[model samples]
Target: MDHEMTPRPDRLALREWHVDDAAAALSVYSHPEVVRWLIPDMDRVPGVAAMRLLLQQWIAESTRITANGGRWAVYRVADGRVVGGAVLLPLPPGDEDWEIGWQLHPGVWGQGHEEDCAFTLASLAFERGHSEVFAVVRPGNTSSAAVRRNGMHWVGETSKYFGIDLQVFRLRKADFDRTAPEGHQPPTYADI
Candidate 1:
């Protein structure tokens, strides 16, 4: 578990958010293009101060996150730059189904960051014993292609999770296993 939690010096890494990441996080959250595709409830991060405050809140709330889930800051291994955020958590209302999501800086868009985040988190979820994981994208959002690239199947739309219509895609453990590289294991959240 200790080894699993340690940040990998690979193409990308996932670890818990840090206060100093506000500026990098802002790069992802404050952009109009990124914000426009996010869930309706989330607004543009506004500024670095606001991004810092949000990171603080997310860090505090992270402690209460379930053992199999967490909120993480995505980093580019080559430059150690914060490129985005990733999360794998149970959906709201019933909290029975898990959801996998990521937000990347516009500069890194279409560079496999989204797919890496999705596959890593989905692998972690499956390794943690979940049978399936879902991704919900707002209609007309072009990011759905990344989800499909990760092998998730379109499962139709439903407003149940976020109180707004979204295109739901699902990836079963068996399906994910078929595409996952042999012996591939994502960084874990043991420290969190």
Candidate 2:
């Protein structure tokens, strides 16, 4: 899956996560309401420095994700805030299905940022030539589960992801075709 990523600027660009993003990321990831929906390991993030190290690691791993697909800081177009994060990476080392995930600050929740970021990234993934994209969500995290309305379909549950009972949602390239044009652009905050 190694390949170059497509550049996006209209909705929100999927740029590499950075050390500077650590504080903003912490603002989103450290919130009890938001982090609860993420993988349990995130519970170990103690403070800003730990979050900075994590973000540094994210920058270190950026090349791999970019080679396979991409991950990003979820750069907001309107005000240029780092709302949260988004990624379309390989399904672990042995699997073929690519995974898409999004995390947005609760302050920005219900503002459509999650949908726009996820949509833009997924569309970029299709452009990068992946046959399918998947999103794994905690059964209780109804917020992330909203990928269903954006063209992903329920594919049952699995504990394979982070050893948790999670609901899986999938969207094939055909699913994209039936749902959106090949070059479709996702909506931005201004467009909302």
Candidate 3:
């Protein structure tokens, strides 16, 4: 988690969120569409000042997480635009299962940034010696498509995580190796 994160040049880049990124992050987290999907654990970030405080907390918390887990800001490598964020962390309560999650601004939705972000974080978990990673989504959330495309298999609904009903998807390290080989990048829109 503390190591420098650099995804493929052709794909998205993952880095620790900085306080200066608050404005760009606001563009993603404050959107009504994005917030509706987030629901309970997160709400629409009201302003740049509030978002900066939140980022500060995240930065401080990352230091206490000794596991290979942390939150990252997702960026488009081509233009260096902040699309959203990605996270690799332990599922709460049990803290045994690894979870991978991502969020992208509505402005960049359906352009494959979701899949790239999800895959990038999950791959990082695997490389850090985790055997598998999970993704839990709100029942009706459309992000499931990106999760599936990233090679995560549906594992059915469960309220075990976050004490809320949600659909869960999982991916193993072996499954990832088959889906995206070394040096292989996720498909672009044209490639799809």
**Number of the top-ranking candidate, with TM-score as the measure:** 1
lDDT of 2 by residue, 86-160 (tens): 777777536577888878778878755566555666677776778889888887886874587678898999887
Candidate 2 clash pair list: none
In terms of lDDT, the poorest run of 10 residues in model 2 is 1-10
Clashing pairs in 1: none
Question: Judged by lDDT against the true structure, how good is candidate 3?
Answer: 0.77
lDDT of 1 by residue, 16-125 (tens): 89999998999899888888877646899889999999999988877887678878888876777888888888888698989998888888787666667778888778
Where model 2 places Cα greater than 4 Å from the true spot, the runs are 1-12, 180-192
Residues 115-155, candidate 3, lDDT per residue (tens digit)?
Answer: 66676677678767799999989988865688888788999
Model 3 misplaced regions, further than 4 Å: 1-10, 181-192
lDDT of each: 0.80, 0.69, 0.77
Model 3 TM-score is 0.87
TM-score of 1: 0.88
Q: What does each candidate score in C-alpha RMSD?
A: 3.0, 5.6, 5.4
Alpha-carbon deviation at 129 in model 3, angstroms: 1.1
